[model samples]
Target: MAFDSGTVSFRRYAVMGRSPREPSEKMLQTLEGMSFAPGGSGASQEVEYGWSGGRHVLDTSFSFEHNVFGEALHFALRVDTNRVPAQIRRAYQIIEDEAASLGNAAGKKGVKHAVQRRIEADLRSGRYRRSRLMPVLWDLPRAMVYAAVSPAAQEYLLNLFERTFELRLEPLSAGRLALRRMEAAGNRRSYEDAHPTRFAGGPDGEERAPEYPWVPRGDYPRDWLGNEFLVWLWHHTETEGGVVATGRGELGVVIDELLEMHCAFGETGRDVFRASGPTRMPEAVDALFSGKVPRRIGLIVESGGSQWQLTLSAESFACAGVRLPPAEQAVSPRAVFEQRIDALRDLCETIDALYEAFLKVRFAGAWDAHVAAVRRWIARAARRQGA
Candidate 1:
């Protein structure tokens, strides 16, 4: 799907400012207090803001992030995957639910920006940007669902986060209390959309088929119950030899071309006004496979041995906000794949940075774009899901 969202690079962060803007003394002290000192087996960790002065810590995390635009703080809470025991997958309807609802979503009971202001309390309590931690893998499915919701909804979650995770609340219990609110909203919404509806046969009326042909009887899209994605990845990698499966887990699919392109963009992230474009890695992929990785290729030979030839200069890698490591640092193909993840996270952060611009997307309306993206992702995943 074009929803690949332009693999945004993972821009390194630095604490070069005070309270974002207007650099207040109070804000500086607050920022320092929120930071953690190295401790125990790991490096120094910062005290989280919401639970800074509280006794509660939960199975999940409540974090207050500093938005780059420096206009506001984005407060969020997410659940941990580890605590989602396997047994729960079968016993309950949902094994895990991790979403960051925005505080400013419409229908919330607060003045605009009121929720954002409260996030300041997190600052004073010693919960700064580092408190939530960086490079943490987000719940991709939950993020996809969030993408399905409205921006106002995103803002609303942000606001509610500020309130529920006050400096005095325990982090863990706060999560449970917050989830109750979510479940309550879900219950009411479920009934609202429960009006009876019926579907008629197709126009040709050859034979009746279910609404979702991929699903069998009594089956839902139970993500936890299935590693359907990995299953699909395994098969695809087997069939498409050019795309090798990772030795570890299948975090994502990687094209050989993306690796080369990553090497190309490796040194350019520092430019704020950098240009965005497509990569010419398909050609490079061919070179790596046929020439570099493979010594010689003779058409008349056995016509065997890893018969994978990536298209030359095929240019399948589409990128934006790509940054490469300094050429001084040795780059490898695997590094590219890892960078892809960081790039995507950076894209999310950028989407947030340009919040006002995205709000414009709300007018020209991201509705059509969103719809188009959904269709594309489904089609792509279906075609490539199992090769």
Candidate 2:
């Protein structure tokens, strides 16, 4: 039986510049060569160094399920020196010291060299201990890539993609994403006009304590839009009963029992307040009154009688812990994979639609009234809680 059963974390990206055509046979070969085949880039070479990739995984073809097509790539990298155990280093040092104590200078030096060589060889061969597998998803129609990993690994994968395809990877920044959504909604708002405002407050030490002490200067101003979006979602769900009609259809959204709130644009007292079980708790209301807003939130989305749970970050709009609908009975692994991916895609589409609705209201000059309603809601919740 497997021991580790932790949930997979997902991070989404809008793939730019990939050819519109489906993955051709030649393209698939290139991907395989660059990933698990020999004579590839550093990532692929590293994987081979650890586990003989060409002999093991190179024969594997990219899998397709529903509209998603992609492959899983595994590789290893050097461990951080800081992470090496002190005991391990000490043992190596002791061996070197003992070797150096031998009588003849030449003999001692030779012995020391041998010991060092042995240690290096061990390290090079032990890379499998640190290997990681990153699952990449390509949405053919949308030209998007969703990786089942953290941004740290995503960076390496982006480099790999560039090396494989000979194309640049343009990350979908918040500004760009907003522009696209606005264009899709036909809002006609200039990008500059619709762009989220950045806080100009200097270093946290300079500013006097404001009435809203909990609102901290956001880590990144560009991310303010995303944070506000999540805050707005919470308010919308609470006041509107977690269901709203979009242009296409109705969306069912709710903040699950788990909610996390942090100061959006301040440095001091940037404590993260988390609430689980009933988002309407007084503690959560007090956190808002203290000027805190959502930096990330756990969400439950229902579309067409299907439900998904995911955690969305306010900064990059990156999602994690996405639990899609269960797969229907299937006779083969491929069929099951396809069903699961289709469910995941459907869930992401629902979120995108909801976000589009938010942009329409936010940029249509109705944001102030929305903010006012949120303030009143917070006040009532706080009053009821005696905070």
Candidate 3:
């Protein structure tokens, strides 16, 4: 368990509708108490918000592309050991402390695996099981915007890591998870076997580990990415039903952007479904029936009556599928949604059957509650006459 990996990707998540509140004196004092240094009069000093440390994230990124789910203001941080300055011990202390906090955010059962828990604690203590952080990396300042997330609740406490140590970091996206994990685990890749389900093999070899039942089905092509692979998938889907695509090719363009879900997942360190826009609904049933890729999704929708508020989320969500109960094995989001879809289709079938029964017989109170006496009588007669 000797430490021997590359840079560690740390995350902190928070939720709040209120805009940035001026840091209270008590808040600043608490941070100072925690050893988070205010910007110094040295090369990295600032006049206002000098309370801010190395501002690398801001210096490197201005108005970074912001993505959200539920109610979170998401961002990233990378601790470049190659650039750490000598007077930043206090800063490193805060980073370590904040990372520890993230690891413990969910408490004892918070972590998904015992090994992950060990890694989290070890990572907080800078006791990498395989390798140490690269030397000479400099960290800059970051911000922890307010957010509110749910279900997996993984985005909790990212802002703590940001304000404490000035670093640039982001979680891995779904598709790009392979690359990110490969880097983090390095020689210790076996560590990820801890995942309840893995979206790694075959053209679609997925996770079989059902220990962590909350894991959702992924949208990635089991193992294909390039053209030939895509072609193979295209033909395969055709066999089920023609591939679902936009009439004007908008879907293709949108899909490319969606592919970055892998990167987004890695950066945010959360598994987010690569959702399709509701701009145009699917043309075929297979696209959704397979409950596979190009997920049955919507961007934003108008809810009840009329309103300007949006109802669509950028995350992947399935409304039907056989679910992995708390006691059973873990399943994918797609699986869960497919289960729901199946249930709905089944429900439809059941209702269709019941409607047929009613059509054949006139049951008591079957007519509208407000039906006129003569209308009700006529309806009853029609039912008896097989009308």
Q: Which candidate ranks first by lDDT, i.e. highest?
A: 2
Clashes of 2: 5
Q: By TM-score, highest first, what's the ranking?
A: 2, 3, 1
Clashes of each: 35, 5, 74
Name the candidate that leads on TM-score: 2
Deviation in Å, model 1, residue 252 alpha carbon: 9.0
> In lDDT terms, how accurate is model 2?
0.57
| Model 3 regions lying over 4 Å from their true place | 1-23, 32-284, 293-298, 301-387
Superior candidate under lDDT, 1 versus 3: 3
lDDT of 3 by residue, 255-338 (tens): 111211121112212223343522122322212111222222221111111111111111221111211112123175434333
lDDT of 2 by residue, 1-387 (tens): 000113335556666674444555565556545544332333222233111122222234432222223332222111111123456657866776665676433465676676556555555554323434455565556666666545565566567667767755555544446777767757545544544432212234225432223323334224456666776788778878888788659888878656676653454344444455446777677767656666677888888889888787766667777776776786775566656667767876787778777777778667767767777777777788994
| lDDT of every model, 2 decimals | 0.25, 0.57, 0.26
Candidate 1 residue-wise lDDT, 1-387, digit = tens: 111123121211112112133323453245334332333223222222221211122222223232111222221222111122335333332211111133333433343234334344433343333322122122222221111112223333233333432322111111122233335545433322222111112222324321322123242222111111222222233345423223221222222322221111112111111111111223322222121111111110001121111211101111233332222232753344344444344333332222222222222335356435433443344445335
Q: What is the TM-score of each candidate against the true structure?
A: 0.20, 0.75, 0.22
Candidates arranged by lDDT, highest first: 2, 3, 1
| RMSD vs true structure, all candidates | 22.4, 6.0, 23.7
